[model samples]
Target: MDSPNVLLLLTTLSLTVSSAISGSVVEDLANLQPPSDFNTTIMKNCQHNPSLRYCNSSSVDLKEIFRFTIVASHLCNESKNPNCVHSFDKIDLRNRPKIAPLYLSYSFFWKYCPSTIFSIDLSNTSLKGSFPTEVLCCAQIQALDLSLNGLAGEFPIESFSPLTNLTSLNLSYNYFSESKISDSRFFKRFNASSFIHSGLISYQECFKESTSLTPSMLRAATNGFSRKNQIVRSEGVEIYKGTLRDGTEVRIEVYRDCISREKRQEFVEECKVLVELRHKNLVQVLGWCSNRNKRAIVTEWTDGETIEMWLSDSAPPWKLRLKILSGVVAGMLYLQENWPEVVSDIRIDSVLLTDNHEPLLSRFQVGDRYRNSKKIHWFGIFLLEIITNRRSQEFERGEAGFIEHVRENYPENLHEVIDARMKLPENIFDQAKHGIELGLMCTDQSISKHPGLDQISHMINKVYESCLELAPQNHKRSHGDGEEQQDDQSKQQKTTPERSETGDTVYNITCSSQWIESAPVVLKMTSSRY
Candidate 1:
């Protein structure tokens, strides 16, 4: 056959196949049975129990009924409560053994039937994964038993403040990671047995019984605040390495001398804020000393160095850098969501690395009012610092500032500004370009126009995942023949000018059309790089 006829025939066949598949899909969808409303049966049972106030009320909330029925259907064996009747007040599915473990979907407990449910017991249903923070929506709940499960995550201690009526909470026999309740009142309310075998250290255990240290004790620990014991000093704040009487190593942050009434009050307020803040990423405050002449905050000493040292001393791999960025995002999101105040001091020097290379936000200055835009802007500068390995101050005195410099050189001279220490592949370089664009968006001067942490988080995750996918390929390439690798490097440098001139233009057009579009775009870009 001629070329034109052959092409026409193939196109005709493709269209026919597509039409047939479309029709078949439509037919299948039409024949599908609609999901039965489980709420109907629940409502019918409620009608029989007139004694139940919410269930038999004149004005029934169908939304709440729908939510309750959905929750019940998942917990109950046959969509019926243990009493063999649908009930919204209490759901006790404890010790119900099954052939396989039950897996709760993410939406489970997202919206509880408030004022209608009082107790929830799912003690031994083999629940897996983290404790659902959505359970806090059960504001009227008196008793919640999630014991004897495989749930493992940070016990949301700070989140329980909303559960004012919670009289009983049994979290024993689980695999919770940390449960140092910031609220000391919880220690008096709940017995230690409730948290036994959960891998959770009580409040007193995490921070020794004493929450305060005297000035003399701190002085002795730090050798009378000698220069040899000093870690770092900035402004009026000085940090000294100290060891408590019990051999616990710590960092004592002494503020400016408290001579006036206002300074003393400020010291007390700062202490209150530090005591309430607790997360693995944030530096843990063990104790504080508020003397008439001196005020200091002591935090648990972390072993690793600061990010400034990490970047200046050596170039970490792309994967490790992405891990550090992700940790910073997680820590920032936690602070934004849980605390009323904002940490105004976000700098490269403020973040510390752990022995395992985990990033910990070490410095915090809680402001009286929250301004997310300021934090977002600082994070933008911080992200740029990580990408370029250049401090924001480096470009401050130039005609164009840091953000302006990035904007002027992005997609074209992006390669020049990227950290030279860490050589990047073509695919990873695309992600870096996208990151630079995100940083630009975040650093916009308009406070209201900056992207929210949620948006920034989504973009960062996409970049991190793209880097992770290419990590193994890069690893294998790194281990290849040394001479061959050197030859390849030489060839790459020789072609760099031509590639940047032509290949980068096409790549930028493709990427800009779908900038921050979706996860699929990220995957597509990673798979096929210019």
Candidate 2:
């Protein structure tokens, strides 16, 4: 009986030992399934937690960011935070669970915690929220895309006042409506649609040829229309359902001018200089018109307009601003390096605003072209404007605010001049401050002190590199595409209704057409988009 009892005890002990070994093997397998599996287990197990998570908040594997981005969305709640689920070359938010809540708010890019990210794209995700006014968070963001989304409300123009280093932005297909109407007589309340009709919420005034937004003509010859561009009730510029030969919609620009030889000569000279221009940022002259009683310059249309007017009424979100600025810088850099003749004394006043707040480079006539040093100074001033949203010209000696004074006295104090947009998210201020430092370096008083466009571009690119440290992939636009552009705010954005099977899908606006007969030089009409 004793022997039998001992054998039974041994058998029980052996079984216990085997069970322990099997449990150990299972634990090892779970640990080796990659960070993606761990996150999946955590999310599925803890989907209903108070914080929407079921794991320890304290310890995070800071190393597996790359692996996490690939599968975040598949395991995460879709339709809520798309940008967070993916990443780009510059942004990475792997293993960082806390960031999940912030990115979900649809504002972490321009507002909330901008410093926490570098590149953010909430494009066409059917996102619904107020225009993120807090997008003015310091210039840490690089690229932004909120296009094709359900964005409501009049765009907050002043919100993007703080961004300085942004590069690419795409906000197409979103409705830009406002609650307030400055004009209330027509069946439609006076809104941005009065200026532009692409379903975009815009307030920037447009009429000039820029590189930001699509240009629209305000009026045709009407009893020698007064300087006032306000179109009377029925006299509003007409739009219809038509197509250009190339399948591109037909938009005309009418030129009606008074006989003035002096103005005509000036126009001719300006055109001569304009034709000399060759920069990626510069708009291509679609065509021109000069007649006995009229003179006009027809050029390729832009998407948006100047920074000032775009942000005049309200403000754009912060990330959008940065995207605009980056594009502007690329254009400016092109002018500063490849074509100094373009940027030097080209068009200070002609720097029109776009509906989207991007600055358009227009009227590039060689009027008092600056030397190399002055070129650098202007570049810095422009950079300061990009960063702070303050008028560099306003900062004469003895200016009131410290920002303007810095531009006056130090000129390199770009950081000091920054617009008080939203503060950078958390510690991201450090990067923003660094960006300002670079801006200051770019705008230093000394020519040698100032960074050239090439150097500046490199540094700006570095900002993108750093931004990748926080943001995820797919939250940024492709780099070096050279597609970023500004609008000619001088040209309004207006659209007319037309039936396209289901509903009104086409609104063909007429851009003002300039006839060669307008130019007294008797040049042949050889261009396509005149």
Candidate 3:
């Protein structure tokens, strides 16, 4: 009997040992998987409540973060508390989990934390469904962003009435053209751009030439076309800063009297192109007024100055500079893929900076389709200019031109090529160097050698990620040490570049029956020569 009991104990011990080994092997396999895959699996088989997750308070990963009560109270817009506020924090979860579906049903928050919800941002999340009306239950909701989703069908206009406290609502880039609001007052809260491309506004309402404006209205808005109102006076066009009787700020561009019939036709083509193109980065065309004696195009007033002017006055941090360049890249991607003609005249002056430092492209013109080399070369030069803070024209006369200068001068540490005004950390210098290398790639003289817009966008995005990863502790300002690096708030004026002999820098905007007409002048340069 004793021998049989001992045998049974030995057998059970052996089985327990085997189970332990198997468990170890499974954990090792999991560790080998990529973080994204691991997170995906976690999301698929979450043991806890799948709809919501509170941080593990005991975990050191979020030690610097205030306790949930504090964080939740602030998000809920309760009065500030000393325990909730902190002057410093050091939590950096570089490899955090990514949840699938990339969205939370509005009802989930309503059921779990209704009063706690203050903001919901799900832009570019690949969400596909009807808009979540359950969000109305979150009474304290201040900001809601559902842009860049696959959501279709008409929105229930009446549902928005309960969201009276909502300060910001962004529903752009969704399929809701057939959507209608019973109350015009709801429409009053948002800009026209929100409804653009959604088909809420008719095509005729978008690009109706002759803004129903007599010459008198233009003159009246521009103080009788006075010199004070003339913001930009280029060879082919004069831009006037004006305010309409309805309090809308506008930039009125009046073409020169010497505009030929062919150029007028070209302007129409450009306008047709511009009317169809609606992007946040492009300076949007509101309407145009055409008369026998005078022709004018109206654009929304860009609140900030041209990039050239802003760079001159303020030395924005390297991170902000990368953000500005990224915006320009987005504009470039849209122009390259969508426009019928090549953007051969893409120069630094074409970019405008808004009050919040957002970049906008202006002075759009359509040229030959095959001006790829010229376009790429100028884009490269533009990148170089951003890095070196030197004007494109300045690089022409020197023996070591822009391309040569970058290669020779900053070969070891490309961040050395950066403008002295921006004070960034050494850790993010790698990101700055990556941007410089990309600029060189853009300038590749081989007509077919340059990276496509998609590739360029990807590379820029990587650089942006790198910049974002640099911890706040790493940053050191050029002026006063610490957080108060930016204080310059002076606004600069925007302008178009001087006209070139090749073509009119500013062209007339109109729509014509014939799309094609003349051959465009092309500038060819070899990227290999650099």
Candidate 4:
């Protein structure tokens, strides 16, 4: 029978079952005829055990019943476990390699069995690409095990917040990134071992000691301000790479003679705000020192080079570049949502990379007013920089600026602006064009026209997905390029000194030059002046 006829049959059977508890109606639903993928064992179990939650409903939703039956049929392999149909409350399909890439649909158990389903164990089921948010619909779910799978993405802690009853969760042995999980209230409820071997960076170690450090401790870490230990030095500011007694590497920024009282206070205030905000992509601020003659901020040391150096020296593949840009957007979005003021003065150098090329936003400038539009505009420029491998200031020499330059060449001559270092195939090239257009949309001078970071994130992710479809092709090319780039990076790192510098010079609203021409500088801009 066709779908409509099957639905009609189900409706009739439901009506008949509601009228009277007859064996015929139960049998009809159990042996739901052709085309319908109903699990006979599950339907028979429901008929036998009327105590099951959905079994005794007066009037069943035929569609929901159909979905439930389909899910049961797909998940319950009778050959493996003859008793699989007997249970609806707990699903344990562990070590089921045949069910690879399982589609845990939203309505699987949610619509018909939300209240009844308590535990789910899909461990080692070969699940991939993000947490199955469908599981969140089960409000009464107590234990969930999604371990030993290929699931990777930002762990959505906020979505799990409603599941107050969720007691046990095992996300170990996955490729998940540590986004905002470090600061979530739910993380505290679980044991640290639950996330072991998972790609998540432990934030517990970050908060063990006090955030307030004395000048003597800072000096000891940096070898009493030795010249060779210094990373970057500019007017009124000096940065030094330090190693603590416990072997924790840190970057210390010291404000020297030219600092004002107001500037010193702003530094302290910024440190306090940064201490509260924790995201994997943002450089973690470890501690700070403020005394009569000394004022400084200390942040975790990253081994990789700045984004500027990454672009300038080597030709990274399109996929790698997109991944880095995506990370940058993630970090910026976190800052925008949490503290809009810290979203000021975004420069290419402000973004530092890790050994794995993960982008971390190292610079933060707190502004007085919330100007998301300006931040969006800045991000547009940043996006263009990644796509084109050109400095935002370089466009200043042009009559229309970088935004208009791209707008003029978009769709037709976009290839002219794309970084020549990358040799993109047609499919990947299309995504680069899409990225250019997105950057143009973001760089609109009119504040009302600017897209929010969330919207930008969606667009970028869409492009990233498109590129991912051509991964096999892109990977073949990027592999050779990656080897070459790695060799170049090795050479570059030897000659270049690892530096972490934050600038104290406040810029006015109209200053369009590069914050620091050659060095990595975290430029601070007073919001009022900006």
**Scored by CA lDDT, what does every candidate get?**
0.61, 0.40, 0.54, 0.62
**lDDT tens digits, residue span 297-342, model 3:** 8888877888888778787677678778777878878788777473
Report clash pairs, candidate 4: none
Better by TM-score, candidate 4 or 1: 1
State which candidate has the highest TM-score.
3
Stretches of model 1 off by over 4 angstroms after superposition = 1-210, 223-228, 232-237, 396-400, 471-530
TM-score of each: 0.55, 0.40, 0.64, 0.53
Off by more than 4 A, model 3: 1-122, 134-145, 162-170, 189-191, 199-214, 223-230, 233-236, 244-247, 342-345, 396-400, 413-416, 446-448, 472-530
Which digits, one per residue and each the tens of the lDDT, describe model 4 over residues 326-436?
778888887777777675345778788886567888877666565667677778788888988878577665414766777676544555678866876544555565566
What TM-score would you give candidate 1 relative to the actual structure?
0.55
lDDT at residue 385 of model 2 (Cα atoms)? 56
Can you list the residue pairs that collide in candidate 1? none
Model 2 / residue 67 / CA error / Å: 14
Writing each residue's lDDT as its tens digit, candidate 2 over 1-530 gives 22311121122322333234332122232232233344444443334332321134355442232122222222222212333323212333322333433444433122213133455555535566666454445356766656545667676544554555565544545666743332322212211212332244333421132221122221232223333322222332322222222222222334454758777666666665554343334554433445564444545445454556554545543444454545566667766554555553322345655543445566454455666656655555555555556664564542134233643423223234444453344223333444444444444332233445565565454444344334433313321132221124212321222345543222222212111112122211111111
Error of 4 at 492 (Å): 44
- RMSD in order of candidates: 18.0, 23.8, 16.5, 17.6
